[model samples]
Target: MATYAIGDLQGCLSPLVQLLEQIQYHPEHDTLWFAGDLINRGTESLETLRFIKSLGDRVKIVLGNHDLHLLAVSHGFGKLKRGDTLAEILTARDRDELMDWLRKQPLYHYDESLNTVMTHAGIPPCWDLHKTQTLANEVENILQSDRVDDFFATMYGNTPDKWSDELTGLDRLRTITNYLTRMRFCDENSRLDLESKEGVNTAIKGYAPWFNYPTKVPHDCHIVFGHWAALEGKTQQARIHALDTGCVWGGSLTALRLEDKQRFSTPCTLNRKKT
Candidate 1:
């Protein structure tokens, strides 16, 4: 049995299908791990959601910032920005079912056998694996609860750029969500620089990629993430994988085979306008 970790789909289903064909994926014998952003920015949001949902137990996924934004927008908390392509999902007959399934998906996934942790974005430099999982659960609980609307309402912010155990309520949940889903660079003290979305070379002064922070906690596990398409599947660290290859922006859709670390990609046919 093989396990494949795929990058952000961004509603680009054709590439996913082509990549799966290239990898010769077998539903019964293979497992798929998605680094989130399963919808939006492309033209097939509804089809993408339905296809992933149809996979059932064969797949594992974490919510990306785009996914969260879709959830919040569904509730009228977030405004639909230009270039957004999630209207199909919001208007689908099974929209409630799909949204419920998405909101219930975990913010992080850990595989003990592989000693790998997958999040939509990189883990915070300050968090060890245990702290990471625990904090992820805190947000997961609320997202799957009656207070989910409250979460959506306050989920869009860059405040409390640093993490502290003393943080309470929505602040704590929002902070955790940001780190796990939207983070790219952070300062020496682990304060997230939420505005910088470029690659590592362009990091703002005193701010570095989360994985490059000097004070980062050590972890024996490998990390896989996909929010930063600018990295183009390169993190320079063998254990850290950045699999988003910008498929929605005419780049290739990438998949990394976890067992052998073999990568397979299919050039995207969709030519989406960069956002």
Candidate 2:
């Protein structure tokens, strides 16, 4: 059996369908690991969510910022932004089932056989693989519980930009969520500079892409992540894989077969639509 990890879908089901065809995906023998952002931005948010949900056990998904945002909006926490296309999902009859299934997804997925870890955003340098899993579990636990509202209430902030064991309650969960979902630029100390979203070149003096710093991640462990589309699927580190090629922004949808590291892609029709 083989496994493939795909980049952010962001509601672009067409490119995803094309990429799956290009990969010659066989659900019976292949497992698909999605890099999250499965909805929002493009025109088919509702359809995309349904399609991915229909995959059932054949796929693994990690929640991204947009995915979390969709949850928050559904819970009446956040408002839809300018380019957001989540209204269809918000009003769909099966939204409850879809959102329930979504919140149950983990924030990070690790496959020991492949020696790979998948997260929507890269792991924080300070947190080793074990600690990353522990923290991610904290958010996942809350996301699937009745306390989920507490998470969304305290979710939208960039303060307390570093990690510490002393952090408690929603702050602790939010810190873990931010690193796993929205992180981009961070320092060696894991101090996140949440404002910067540009490419590595504009990384603001003390900060750099999360992958640039010396991380506690094992030398042999591969990290497959999405969320920073500005990188355009390029990271100098061999073990660090960036799969988000900005398909929702008129770029392309990409998938990496973990067995051979072969990439399959399809051009998106949405040409630079201000994502």
lDDT of 2: 0.91
Tell me each candidate's TM-score: 0.97, 0.97
- Model 1 misplaced stretches (Cα beyond 4 Å): 214-219, 273-275
Give the per-residue lDDT digits (tens) of candidate 1, residues 8-95: 9999998999999999999999999999999889878789999999999999999999999999999889999999998888988999
The C-alpha local distance difference test score for the whole of candidate 1 amounts to 0.90
For model 2, the superposed segments whose C-alpha errors exceed 4 Å read 271-275
lDDT against the true structure, per candidate, is 0.90, 0.91
Kindly list the per-residue Cα lDDT of model 2 for residues 4-37, writing each as its tens digit: 9999999999888888888889989899999999
User: What is the lDDT, from 0 to 100, of the residue 117 in candidate 2?
Assistant: 98
CA displacement after TM-score superposition, residue 198 of candidate 2 (Å):
0.8
RMSD of candidate 2 to true structure, Å = 1.3
Clashing pairs in 1: none
